[model samples]
Target: MGELDTFTDALDYPVYVVTTAAGERMAGCLVGFASQCSMDPPRFMVWLSKANRTYRVARDASHLAVHTLRDDQRDTAELFGGRTGDEIDKFEHIGWRWPTAAGAATAPVLDDVSAWFLGRVEGRVDGGDHVGFLLSPVAESPAGPVRPPLLLLSDVVDLSPGHPA
Candidate 1:
């Protein structure tokens, strides 16, 4: 492992599925690099690989939805993480709906997730091989029953990415 891996390898971060739609096209991908960057303005950032289809569509999209998966949702993670949107319509197999919330309509909100937030893409930063999307939360799912264990990086470590990063 490399020097950075030495530290990151010891930490397990939650994985998220980010979805975006540009015109008639829609895309979603499993993302490992994301975090809340601010509190006062309620900002979050999600980094997308430049080579991924989601990034391509997101370039024109005004909003995106971030979904938190449960520990038992390995199959959902595999579908989004292991397959390319270039070849398949990943949303067809998954349950999702266009947000009824006014500004959050640009992306599909995934069903049955532990939690999710629809954010407007306020800015994009070119971050080497990936681009960081600064998001301002516009809508979010209401709190449900007791939360379950979240899907984490360690849980999906064996998954081969659908697209080269």
Candidate 2:
């Protein structure tokens, strides 16, 4: 083996919540393993840990909603990132609403988001610990009047998982 990098070191990137509108609302922890993969076609990719409950829901989701948190929205990040939706209804506590885009799924759009994008899952590929989802943006918008600083991995250091890994 070459070497093993600590997950902490490997995960030091902007965190986000990847959500889906299947039967029920679901969301999960996503480190910075996402990026704009295309320009002309307008595509983005997000990698969700296979071990995550959100991935299970997302696998069947028609649309995945991507939300960026404001620095003040760390609480929201912690709830989604550190906890599993398998045992809890995260939407109960978060302020959210459904998108108006045509053919939009039942995913929740965080009300306090800094920015958001609703993408259709164009493709999916297994990436070992995580599954990579290629999303083609169909709808997007800024969340609030004031742009907020994005919450990063460094901001949510104290939160621990509420579900068994």
Candidate 3:
């Protein structure tokens, strides 16, 4: 409706599925707003919608797993972006695991992805309607010889948000 909105609407970035765990509770959401913010310490930031279920669970989570959706993972995108976790148990339907490191169990990690990383939450930044979770990548999944193209926001723009943002 405004110039700022128009500028943002023209932007397209890779989509990500961010998952977090708090005790036995787990939550994940499709995220379009994220980027590598720093190079020195290798920091990645993910903005979680305040209204999304994942934001609530991630509030107290120590770590999070970021899954980069592949070009063919539209179904996976739909499941996370279109369904509300407040009404359903998405994990029960998705194939995920708590990627272990030094036998230290962590959050739910999506099984199939172009790439995923486990990160320790270093800080949080409030961004009006959303919150940015600053991450320090601890472990990354094995990279494939042929890296698949990442799924972009335009690929899932038709999807309505599971929770109002």
lDDT of 1 at 149: 91
Each candidate: RMSD: 1.1, 2.7, 1.1
Off by over 4 Å in 3: none
Candidate 1 stretches with Cα past 4 Å from truth are: none
Which lDDT tens digits does candidate 1 get at residues 1-165? Answer: 666988887899999999999999999999999999999999999999999999999999999899999999999999999999999999999999988874446899999789999999999999999999999999899898788899999999999999997
The clash number for model 2 is: 0
lDDT of 3 by residue, 27-108 (tens): 9999988999999999999999999999999998998899998999999999999998999998888788878761476678
Order of quality (lDDT): 1, 3, 2
**Distance (Å) between predicted and true CA of 23, model 3?**
1.3
Instruction: Name the weakest run of 10 consecutive residues (lDDT summed) in model 2.
Output: 1-10
lDDT by residue (1-165, candidate 2, tens digit) is 325556446665677877786775466554557888899989999988777778888888878888887778878877787777777788887888788873555566877777889888999999878888999988887446776678887788667865433
> How many backbone clashes can be found in candidate 3?
0
Q: Which stretches of candidate 2 lie over 4 Å from their true place?
A: 1-12, 28-30, 143-146, 163-165
Clashes of each: 0, 0, 0
